[model samples]
Target: MQAESVGIVAGMALVLKFGRGDAARCRFAISPLQETMSALLVLKDPGRHGWYLPWLRDVEPVVAGLDLGLLGLAVPSNGHGPDFLWPSPTSPLTRIEDDLAQVRATDPAVVAAELAEQARRLDRHTVPGDLYRALTGDPVAARETLVAQQRTAWRALVEPLWDRMRGLLDADITTRARQLADGGLEGLFADLHRRATWKNDELHLTGFRDGTVDLRGRGLILVPTAFGWPNLGIGPTDNTSATSPALVYPMLGTARLWEPATQSPAIVRLLGSGRASVLTETFIPSTTRSLAQRVDLAPATVSEHLAVLRAAGLVTAKRRGREVLYGQTPLSAALLNLDRF
Candidate 1:
């Protein structure tokens, strides 16, 4: 159905309303900063962020050993946090250090106010009495605490697996870019979420929240994330009031993120080692030469494997410039659970 007004029920959905002026402003991007926040969320409550439970368990030894002291403060157990921590998704992407620097530079007064808001949210819950005592009301101290915790969290969690996560995110962007090119906002939203829709120049997130954000020509940035699965988030991509809008959504192909490099027994039995490796790598696109280099197979051998996979309707190839990029077709994606990667 076409979207006019949507209900974004809490824990169910979030509807993002757009205006005529917002059409030109809609764009897709990848955000490392948002992923960091999501990883912290996973660490804080693996049950709520259950999609990553397996991932957390797989990395438990490392995560369990790390000091998570007071870091959970920045991520409210029940609500949102200060805007400075969620930086805007910039094209060409801003480095995490640069974004953290911005957080460190936050005005002390703003930090104090945000922490107070956070305290109120926590107080409403059945939290430990001593926990509230630990939260400092001093803005300077709170900000410093947050910065130290963030650095610790990144080193402990995100840095180790960032390359794989980034590869999946970049692949998602590539797929979405094709959608945007083929169908503009409509096609992009079609695959974005089961509830997200675009019609009459309005983007609707079909849930229960009753509100509207008029882009007013400010534009919107769509970011795909691996850790924020089963839920989507909408907000300003950065700390600046004037920063462009951004929407961060759960990405596909995350299930295999933590899977070991070894081939799945079932898949290997079905497709053999050479063909199975080719299939797994095709979850994201790669040219023959690139795939050969990555899989350490001869270019001709990789091409032959691609031909067989294409004939089996498990892969598709699209030409870009002088290269032909091969990626998994939907059928193959489902069979291999590539969507979960």
Candidate 2:
């Protein structure tokens, strides 16, 4: 029997839209578990996860030495495979040890069920039989393998960039929290994904499977990721069971993640080196002090450049409480895009 693809190559993509039942149950969270698992996905198929290709290339040498074991096998390189391996909605604050412990504690029944589901959704010979048995039979050992592999991935792939990644993820969460506070859940989902839409008590997502999820009070957990860009993932397939279904998608500020450490010559030519550096760093909203630290310029100097950029309409400023954050406008995006070509 052939298994269905998870949808990257398949004519159809995995769809995860929502309905009225999900409205009241929706909440936001950040999951270390999902981010770690996603890091593996980015590594496995750089093309599928190509949005992060530049970052992947930068860390390739670092991760080349780690033993990923069954991790890569679990999620096929083509981006289609089992869901049980990385079930969504663990916890906003789940630590590495805690997440690994949860994997170790999976009930045999759940494992069996998930295995059966995987068998139906994956190519028959894609996963080696021994690894499958290890995952489902001696599940305890499999959990240990999962934990060890994740730790290796963390040390190699995640730790080096944890500070920047954490900052981006936290900022996203804070922004979404503010959105929720201002306009409620509907407002929060407004800018979530271009493909995702909330309307008439239903959330519609395009470019993927057409299905409706009945929240039934379990609610939807919104998770933002630094690497889960260019695609949206909805999970815990059987939402009827325990563990809330979460829509894990890319955060808003990913374009800035790949910014070169040094200023771009093309941009430098246009704005001069100092203003160009400020322009590049401001792709993601940043406070004057943060931009100063990132570019190693004084706050006063960064503020002056920001004022000029804002005056020229290349950047815009918004007040978030006590501080004014500067971000790139369409003009800035155009400038960066031009540099890429």
Candidate 3:
């Protein structure tokens, strides 16, 4: 659970908007875990066991910055589950302590060797180890090795690295980062320097591959959540080195777009309402209607509408139970009331 906070740090460091920490935080912050959270929310109802990881990613920052006494009301919550619920699993602080305890017991050198092996394993695209070793080897290698190394190296190396990297930012690195973060990340690429080429369904980033990444064909790439364009193009590394245990691959892509179909029109209308669209006809912060509720519209008809809306950036659907709910696109709120006109 705590290992997931690595994402919090990484998200805060890379994505610009998750900085001030709000809905924008979910947009830029919790995106990588979108599928994971959606799948869990689908497989079981929200607040179920399978959802621990994604929910933690979603709520941690808000909670960390929140005062415990007023946590309930401080959360600007609406809807059924996620926005209002906190899981009763171990507290994040407890999980952090447990993880640290296990880390303290292991030899740092051994963990480092294991991490190197894991990196090599990724390049080979296979876990090359005996069954016994595979079963018993470090599930914690990526966590204990790289993140720990980063923390250890931070005091001595962060300043030097920051100096080199910020030559492009034009001001002191930390100051610039805080400023850029607060400015909501729009200015991040204004005076950017580097060659990032778009090619063959992927982007190639150059000029910033310092020692932050090893020579294992692994570096970070940032892609847009709204532009269908690759932004910070960095590493998409598989952090684990064990047998393929249900792996998740996250794609950094664009916002759902709008099309000119029946489904598309309906979805665009709901999304124009400025709330989340759970299904084709549902409008959050106001109304939720099933396809059947929409007169002769068939269930499949509504599902079809949802698909179009999803493509057009008009709505978003996250899995829940046997049903899928749709919500409106926040981007096109102004046009919502015009549906009546």
Candidate 4:
């Protein structure tokens, strides 16, 4: 059955009802294409998404050369865009090529309908004349054009920085998995987003169009995205052909994702420059070797600082196989004014 908007509250909420086996079926995924589409919104209004300004500044040249007329029209500042652009990821490691292929393979009829829907949402009866004519005249070609543009966008914006982005995304998934294991679905949803809530087997997301989606045991896909800050996205809302429903939410550690770790003067005064720099970089988990490379310190020196910090209750170390990963403790986050979200 198709999910439909049920009722409207003062603050809109999209409610996804979980069935008997739905809880077990829910899983986390990382999508490069989803990040690409979200990045477009940031590009459209960089002021609104200040977290991405650092990235924007770096890609300004690429942004200036590209033709964003079509993509810009599709993804407005309000963040509602075509569903076909973001197909539900089948696995945790869904690739951009596979997602782009799914988009390219979209039915021409579906493309036409979605374009019309976008136009309607933008308060216009139809799209711009030339684009409308192109859609009505030959949707397959239009689809190809859109996909080609998307590929260009992926190469220019997301590809070069994917490793860093993926590291952040993977860390979030690891945290979510731990939440699921320790406290079950409740723990997972509790921290998913401030706008998301879990109650009575129903997952309600605020700031979304009111809807009731009965999963019917098909389950839900939880996607962690780097560029999906300050908003939650529900997919396959009404009339799209996706196997399962998905929720795209901003991941943790985004506020500092683009910023370089510098020694805070106050921190430095207290812990000395070397330890403070190591502490600053430990906000996100890293190994001693990686931390050394990042802070331009020797591995032994970083390890010594980590030992001191760990002994002082400022850092914690977890052993994963042969490598030991170090991360900040709650005390360290409070000291650094870092958001643990």
Work out how many backbone clashes candidate 4 has. Answer: 0
lDDT of 2: 0.68
Task: Summarize candidate 2's per-residue lDDT along 1-341 as a digit string, tens digits.
Answer: 01123443333433444555656667777766667777777776677645587878878777767777566655554433455556555555555667566666777566555555554655658768876666556555655686678777777776665545655775687788889789876797798887677666556655555445566667778888886666677766564766677777788777657665556688888888899988887766777877888888998999999999999999988775566778788988787778568
Q: In terms of TM-score, which candidate is stronger, 2 or 4?
A: 4
Q: Clashes in each model (backbone N, CA, C under 3 Å)?
A: 19, 2, 28, 0
TM-score of each: 0.70, 0.67, 0.23, 0.75
Arrange candidates, best lDDT first: 4, 1, 2, 3
What lDDT would candidate 1 get against the real structure? 0.69
Query: What would the per-residue lDDT of candidate 1 be over residues 1-341, giving only the tens digit for each residue?
Result: 01112334555433445666666777777766677778877766688644576678767888767655555655754334666666666652445677678788888886777667667766536655544555655677767777777777777778666655655776788878888889888888887876676777767665524456667667888888787775666664232456666777778777767655555667878988998888888766767776776678999999999999999999998775556778888888777863346
Alpha carbon lDDT at 231, candidate 2: 69
Candidate 3 positional error at 50, Å: 35
**Candidate 3: where is the Cα deviation over 4 Å?**
1-196, 200-202, 210-233, 236-323, 329-341
> Which candidate tops lDDT?
4
The lDDT values for all models are: 0.69, 0.68, 0.30, 0.78
Determine the C-alpha RMSD for candidate 1 after optimal superposition of all C-alphas. 6.9
Let me know the TM-score candidate 4 reaches against the reference structure: 0.75
Q: What is the per-residue lDDT of model 3 for residues 63-174, given as tens digits with 9 covering 90 to 100?
A: 3333222112111112112210111111111222332343445454544454444344332334334422432355444333423432332222222222111111111222
User: Between 1 and 2, whose TM-score is larger?
Assistant: 1
Per-residue lDDT of candidate 4, residues 1-341 (tens digit): 11122232567777888889999999988788889888887786688666677898899978889875676666656645678877888776678988899899889898887877766666445457675555445668778878888888989999877755665786898889999999988999998888789999899877667668888878889898888786678888663334787788889888767988766677788899999999998877778877887788999999999999999999988775466778888999788763332
Q: In model 3, where is the ten-residue run with the lowest total lDDT? A: 83-92
**For residue 46, what is the lDDT in candidate 3?**
35
